[model samples]
Target chain A: DQQVKQNSPSLSVQEGRISILNCDYTNSMFDYFLWYKKYPAEGPTFLISISSIKDKNEDGRFTVFLNKSAKHLSLHIVPSQPGDSAVYFCAASAFIQGAQKLVFGQGTRLTINP
Target chain B: AAGVIQSPRHLIKEKRETATLKCYPIPRHDTVYWYQQGPGQDPQFLISFYEKMQSDKGSIPDRFSAQQFSDYHSELNMSSLELGDSALYFCASSLAAGRETQYFGPGTRLLVL
Candidate 1:
C-alpha cells in the first residue's frame, strides 16, 4: 500500500509564476515531512522540511505548508525559474525500532516554461 | 559539502546471477538506508543500519542481504536475481542524532536480463 501519494504526475507553469505541488499521507504517525528535487540521472536534493507540530516553514523562494488534520502538505515555489524544473518528491518520516524510515510519494514532474 | 557515495553507477547481469552494490556515507554519519525504485514507481525502502548494526527492515527479499562496516560503508548483496529486480538502487545517509534528513546517492542502475 502506498502510504504517501502525489496524485499529480506532472505540472507545467510559466517562468516567474508560482508553482504548487501537493501530497497526501495516510499514516498519522509520521512526525517529519520533507521535499526533495531531483534532476534526470541525479540524486534527490533537499529542499525544505517541516515538523508535525508546525503548520508552515519557509526558506527563500520555497515554502512548505502542512495541515495535520487534513493529512496533506504542499510545496510552493514562487517565481519559478527554469532551473526549478525537476521531479519533486514528498516524503514522510516515521521512527521505527529507534530509526527513521522514509516513505516517498510517486513524485510530481514540474516544468517551467519561459 | 561532501555527500553519500555509491559505486558502479550502472550494472548489467543475467537472471540468477549475483550482484553487489556498495555505499559510502559522508564522514562522521552514523546511519545508512537503502531504497529500490522500479520504473514509473515511487522509491521503496529496503533496509537500514545505524552505527554498524541493523536498525530497520522494509520490503527486502530473502535473497537480498546487507551489512554496515565499522568504517561506515554498507553493501547490498542480491542473489538469484530476477528480471523484476532490475531497478534503481539508492543509498541515503544521515546522522542519528540530527533531524530526519537523508541525503541520497546518485543511484545505481541495474539491468537484469
Candidate 2:
C-alpha cells in the first residue's frame, strides 16, 4: 500500500550544496509528478516534472515542488554535483484503464560529497 | 537519442524455471510499462501497454504474462519461477500522446535458484 513515499533512505550532500529530496502521496488521483535519476545499474533517468495544477517546476539545476494540500513532493538539486550522486525516485501519475501508471518512491540515496 | 530496450541483461533460473523478458519501445513509442524491483524494494507496477492493447494492471502474478507486439515489442512471461522471483526488471516507454514522460530500460537482472 505504499502509495509512493520516499521517507529518505539516505542522503548526504556537500559537493556544491543544496540537495533536497522528499516525496509523499496517498493517491489524490495523482495527476502527474516525476523525478527519476538512478545510476548504479542505470535505468531511471528522466528528471523533473510536475502537474496537478502546478506548484513549481524548473529545469536548469533541477527543481520540482508540488504541495497539493501537503500530499507533498519535492526535488531540488541546486549546486550539487559529482554527477549528482544517484538513486532518487519519486513518481506518481495515475490514469488507469486508458493506461499511464507509475507510482514509485522508496528511493533517495543521493550522496554527493566533494 | 533513443532509449528503452531490454533483453538478456542477465538471467539465471532453476526452480520451476521459465523466464522470458524483453522490451523494445521508443521509436514512435506507443506506451508500455512493466516494473519489478525487489531487493530493498520500490518499483512495482507490473503491467501496461497501449497501442497494441492490454492497457493497465499491476502487481501482476498468476505465473505472469504480458504481450504487446505489432513491432512495438514487449514480453514478460515468467512461469512457476519463485525464490521471490528474484527481481529487477523494468521497461518503460511512453507516447500515448506523451503520457507524461516515461523512458527506462536498463534492467533485467533475474536470478532464481
Candidate 3:
C-alpha cells in the first residue's frame, strides 16, 4: 500500500511564476512532512519541512503548508526559477518500532520555463 | 558542509551473485538509513541503524542484511541477486534516529543481469 501519494506526475510553470506541488497521505500516525528536490543520478536534497503542530512553514521563496485534517500537504515556490526545475518528492515521517523512517511519494517533476 | 558518501557508484552483476554496498555518514552522525528506488518508483525504506545497532526494519528481503560499524558507517549486503533486484540504492544519515534532517548520498546503481 502506498501510504503517501503525489497525484500529479509533472508540473510546469514560467519564470517568476508560482509553483505548487501537492501530496497526500493515508497514514494518520505521520506527524512530520518534508519536501526534497532531486537531480538525475544524485540523491535527494532536503528542501522544507513542517510539523503537525504548524499549518505552514516558510523559508525564503519556499513555503510548505500542512493540513492534518485533510491528510495533505503542499510546497509552494514563488517566483520560480529555472534552477528550481527538478523532481520534487514529498515524504512523511513516523516512528515505527522505535525508529523514525520516511515514507515517500512517487515524486513530481517540476519544470520552470524561461 | 559534509555529506553522506556511497562507494561504487555503479555495479553490474550476474544473477545469483552477491553485492556489498557501503555508506559513510557525515561526521558526528549516528543514524544511517537504507532505501531502494526501483525503476520509475519512489524510494522504499529498507532498514536503518542507530549507534551501531539495528534500529528499524522496513521491506527488506531475506536475501539482504545490513550493519553499522563502530565509526557509524553502514553496509548493505545482498546475496543471490535476481534480475528484479536491480535498482538505485541510497543511504542517508542523520544526527540521531528520530525527527532529524537526513542527508542522502548520491546512491549506488546496481544492475543484475
Candidate 4:
C-alpha cells in the first residue's frame, strides 16, 4: 500500500503566480513531511519541510503547510519562476528515533509558463 | 560545497555480472543512503548507513548489498545482476537518521542487459 500519494501527475502555472502542489498520506504515524525537486538526469534536491508540531513553515518564497488531522500537505511557491519547473516529490517519515526511513509519493511535475 | 558525489555516471552490464556504485557524502555528514528510481516510480529506499553501521534497509533482494567506510563514504554492490535491475541509483547523505533533510548526488544510471 502507498502511504504517500500525489494524485496530480502534472500542473501548469503562469510565471510570477502562486503555484500550489498537494500531497496526501495514509499512515497516521507520519509526523514529518518534506518536499524535493528533481530535474531530468539529476537527483532530487531538498526544498522545504514542516514538522508536525507546526501547521505551517515558510522560507523565502517557499511555504509548506501540514494538516495532521487530514493527513495532507501542500507546497506553495509564490512568484513561481521558470527555474521552479521540475518534478516535485513529497516524502514522509514517522518521526521515530534511530533509523526511520522515508516513504515517497510518485511525484508531480510542475511547469511554469514563460 | 560538495553536496554528494557518485561515481560512474552510467553503467552498462550483462546479466549475471557484478556492479558496484560508489558515493561520497557531504563533509561532516555521518549518514549515507541508497535509493533506486524506476520508470514512472518515485525513488525508493534501499539501504542506509550511519557511522559505518547499517541503520535501515528496505525489502530488496539479497543480491543488493552496501558497505560504509570509516570516513562515511559508502558503496552499493550488486552481484548476479538481472535484466530487471535496470534503473537509476541515487546516493544521499544526511546529518543523522529519521526526518532530517538529505543531500543528494547526481545519480548513476545502470543498465543490465
Candidate 5:
C-alpha cells in the first residue's frame, strides 16, 4: 500500500517561472512530512519539511504548504532554475514506524527549461 | 563537514551471491537508514539503526539486513541475491531518533544477474 502518493509523473516549467508539486497521504497518523530532491546517479537530498501542526514553512526560494484536513502538501519553488530539474519525493513518517523510517511517494520529475 | 558517505559505488553479483554495502554517517549523527531505489521508483526504506541497535525494519525481505557500529558507520548485507535485487541503494543519517533532517550518501548501484 502506498501511503504517500504523488500523482504527477512529470512537470515542465520555464526558467524564472514558478513550479508547484503536490503530494497526498492516506495515513492520518503521519505527523511528520519531508521533501527530497534527487538527480540522476545521486542520492536524494533533503529539501524541506513541515510538521502537521504547521500550515506552512518557507526557506529561501522553497516553500512547503501543508493542509492537514486535506491530507495534502505542496512544494513551491519560485523563479525555478535549471538546477531545479530533478525528481521530487514526498515522504511521511509515523511514530509507530520510528522517526528514521520513511514512506516515500512515487516521485515527481520536475524539469526547468530555459 | 562532509555529508553521509557510502562505499563501493557499484557492484555486480550473480544470483545466490552476496552483496555488501557500507555507509558512514556524519560525525555526531545518531541514526542511520538504508533504502532501495529501483528503476522508475522512489526510494523504499529498508531498515534503520541507532545507538548501536536496530530501530526499524521496513517492508523488506529476510534476505536484506543492516548493521551499525561505532556511532559513525553502518552496513547493509544482502544474502542469496536474486535478479530482482538490482537497484540503487541509499544510506542516510539523521541527528537523532526523533523527527530530524536526514543527510544522504551518493548511493550504491547493485546489479544482480
Candidate 6:
C-alpha cells in the first residue's frame, strides 16, 4: 500500500525555466510533509518542508504548496539550474508509536537541461 | 553542520553470513531510524529508536535486529543473509521523537553473494 504517490515518474525542463513536481497522499493522519533532493549514490538531502496547518512555504528559490483538502502537495523551483537535476522525493510524516516515520513516494527524476 | 554518520559504506557477504552496520547520530539528536532502498525503488522504513529504546517497527525481517546505545549510536545486525537482502541501508536521526525532520546518513550498501 503506497500511501504516498508521485504520479509523474520524470520531468524535464530547460535551465532558467520553472519546474513543478506534484505529489499526493492517501493518509490524512500525516501532520507534516517534506520534499527531498537526492543524487546518485548519495543520501537524500533535506530540501524544504511544510506543516499540515500551513498552505504554503517558500525558501530562496524553492516553494512548496500544500492542499490539505486534496491531500496533495507540490514543489516548485524557480529559474531551474543544472544542479537542480536530481531525483525528487515527496515524503509525509505521521506519528506512530512514539516516533515519526516517513512515507516516501516513488520519486520523480527532474532533469534540468542546460 | 554535523550530519548522521554510518560505517562500512559497502559490505559484500555470502548467504548465511552475518553482518553488522553502525550509525552515529548527530549531536543532541534523540531519535534514530533505519530504511532500506533497493535498486530502482523508494526507501522503505524498517525501524526506529528513541532514547535508547525501540519506539517503532516497520517492514524489518525476523533475521534483523537493532539496538540503540547510551551514546546515541545505533547498530543493525543481520543474520543468515539472503540474496534479497542486498540493498542500501540508510540511518536517519532526528532531534526529537514525533513530527521531526530526519537527517540521513550516506548509507551502507550491502551485497549478498
List ranges where model 2 is wrong by over 4 Å.
A1-14, A18-30, A34-51, A57-74, A78-86, A97-100, A103-110, B1-14, B17-35, B38-44, B47-56, B59-79, B82-84, B88-111
Q: By descending TM-score, how would the candidates be arranged?
A: 6, 3, 1, 4, 5, 2
Lowest lDDT 10-residue stretch of candidate 5 chain B: B63-72
Tens digits of per-residue lDDT, candidate 6, A38-77, equal 9988888999999999999999999999999999999999
TM-scores of chain A across candidates = 0.99, 0.34, 0.98, 0.96, 0.96, 0.98
Off by over 4 Å in 5: A97-99
lDDT of candidate 1 over B1-113, digit per residue (tens): 99999988999999999999999998888999999999887889999999999899999999999999999999999999999999999999998824569999999999999
Cα deviation at A64, candidate 1, in Å, is: 0.4
Model 4 lDDT, residue A106, Cα:
96
Each model's DockQ score: 0.67, 0.27, 0.86, 0.82, 0.75, 0.85
Which candidate gets the maximum TM-score versus the true structure? 6
Residue B44 of model 6: what lDDT?
98
Fraction of the native A-B contacts that model 5 recovers: 0.79
Model 3, range B57-94, lDDT digits (tens) per residue? Answer: 88999999999999899999999999999999999999
Q: For residues B16-109, what per-residue lDDT tens digits would candidate 5 score against the true structure?
A: 9998899999889989989899999988888888887898887678988888987569999899999999999999998888878788999999
Candidate 4 lDDT at B36 equals 94
Candidate 3, A1-114: lDDT as tens digits = 889999999999999999999999999999889999999999999999999999999999999999999999999999899999999999999877789979999999999999
Reference-based lDDT, residue B19, model 6: 97
- Model 2 residue pairs with clashes: none
TM-score of chain B of 4: 0.96
Off by over 4 Å in 4: A95-97
Checking candidate 5 for backbone clashes, the offending pairs are none
* Least well predicted 10-residue stretch by lDDT in candidate 6 chain A: A94-103
* Interface RMSD (one decimal) of model 3: 0.7
Better candidate number, 4 or 6, judged by DockQ: 6
